[model samples]
Target: MAKKTVEAALKVEKLKVEITKLKETKKNIDQKNKQLKKLKKKETKTKKSKVEKIEKKKTKKKKVTQLTERKTKEAKEKEKQKAKEAKEKEKQKAKEAREKEKQKAKEAREKEKQKAKEAREKAKEAKEKAERTLEEELQEQLSPEEIEGFQIEKVNMEKLTNKVCVILAEKETTGMIQSELWKKLKLSSRDGSRLALKLERMGTITREKILEKGRWTYKLIIKKTPISTESIENAPCLTCPVEQKCTLEGEVSPRTCEWIEDWVTIEIKKPKTAQ
Candidate 1:
């Protein structure tokens, strides 16, 4: 009975020791569980931060790509606008050029019309002037008898002819109009017109058709002056005793007259005097 009680006490002690060891093991397991839980929490926080950073990067890249596309679109639009403006400017320039050409052509046509009008007027004036002269018209209205009977009264023909020559000489080669000559000579138009015609017919004056005081008229120019009386002062016919009987085909002919021959010879030998 004593051995059995000792054995039982030993057994109780072993059991107590086993209980203490179990309590220590339980504490160690609790501590390990706490550490594992803290590490898991830290790992979860790191993963969340990485995910947020990746999201931010993706958003930034998207914004950058959108900005690049927008800028490229804007550039393309600007280029299109520039090209449109250039085309419009070119069209405007062409329109202006066409307008300028049209204006030039119009002005040229107007100038040509004005030139043609002026030419027509000039031709009309020339045709009227060429129709007839005043002196010719005056003579055509007179009869042959009236023209033959026309003479200046109280005027010596030789003196009158010499005075007309002197006046014409003063006017040089340009000559004087018939109206101005008649006024200076104090002669009537009727007599003056007849005298001018007679002088022109006699080969002592020439008549040129001209426009004077807006009328067709004559310009008289001296062709030859009248023979001076002094030129015949020593002529034998004036003093010859047979002057009445002397004729070109008579018995007392000038062709066989010795005195006339001698007088002609002497006049030919004399030096000519200037008028």
Candidate 2:
């Protein structure tokens, strides 16, 4: 029993040494945990300082971008304003040019009217002078006996007809206006018109209505040939020569007659000759 008790006492003393070693190990672990916590705090503080610096740099760059963008906007606005001013200037110049053109046109119209007025006045004065001189010359040349019987009378119809025929022949024109004939004839409009109507009735000319000078005027188509249409209607062959039986295949045919064939062959192209 003494031997067993001594072994159990030795075992209890070994357990006591192990408990003291465990207490020391726990104290070392607590010291290492405190050192790690301090290191973590220092790392977080350095990271926060770097983040603040980055934020400040980023804000400074944004301010620079904004200033440049604002400058560009101002430049665009200035360009727009300059373009607007230039457009307005061009419009003003156009308006002034139009006004100047209108003024020039008005001046030109007025000048034309003044010229026409002067021409009319000069013509009137010349006509009066000519009439006075003609009257004086007539008075000076006439004898007292001739002057007593020198009464004005209408122009002779035959003389007027000859004058008109001569005028038409000289002009050799296909047609003429009524006013044109009076200018050459020096006859009043009413007298000239009557003469033209008389000539038309005599079949010496044809008159057609045509618009001229914004009014209807007569166009005189002269038939001045000596061969009258009556001469054709009174032809000897037209009255005699079997006029009813004259045909291409009949006994009295135009093709068979030597005189008709010869005349047609030569005069077909000559409109002046009566075929």
My TM-score estimates for the predictions, one after another, are 0.39, 0.29
lDDT of 1 by residue, 1-275 (tens): 77888888777877778877787787777777777777777777777778878888888888888998898899989899988989998999999999999999999999999999989988988886575664667678876666545566666666676777879878867899888998988877777788788777777789988767676778889888878786578998888898999989999998999998999999879863321
| Ten residues in sequence with the least summed lDDT for candidate 1 | 144-153
Candidate 1 segments exceeding 4 Å error: 1-29, 104-275
Best by lDDT: 1
lDDT of each: 0.80, 0.67
Q: 1-275 in candidate 2: lDDT tens per residue?
A: 78777877767776666766777777777777777777777777777777877887788788888887888888998899989989999999999999999999999999999999989989988865544432234446655455433322465455556556766766566678778988877766655665666576566777776767765667777676444443344344565557877778989877677666655565445443110
What is residue 214's positional error in candidate 1, in angstroms? 13
Stretch of 10 with least lDDT, candidate 2: 266-275
After superposing candidate 2 on the true structure, give the runs of residues whose Cα lies further than 4 Å from its correct spot: 1-46, 117-275
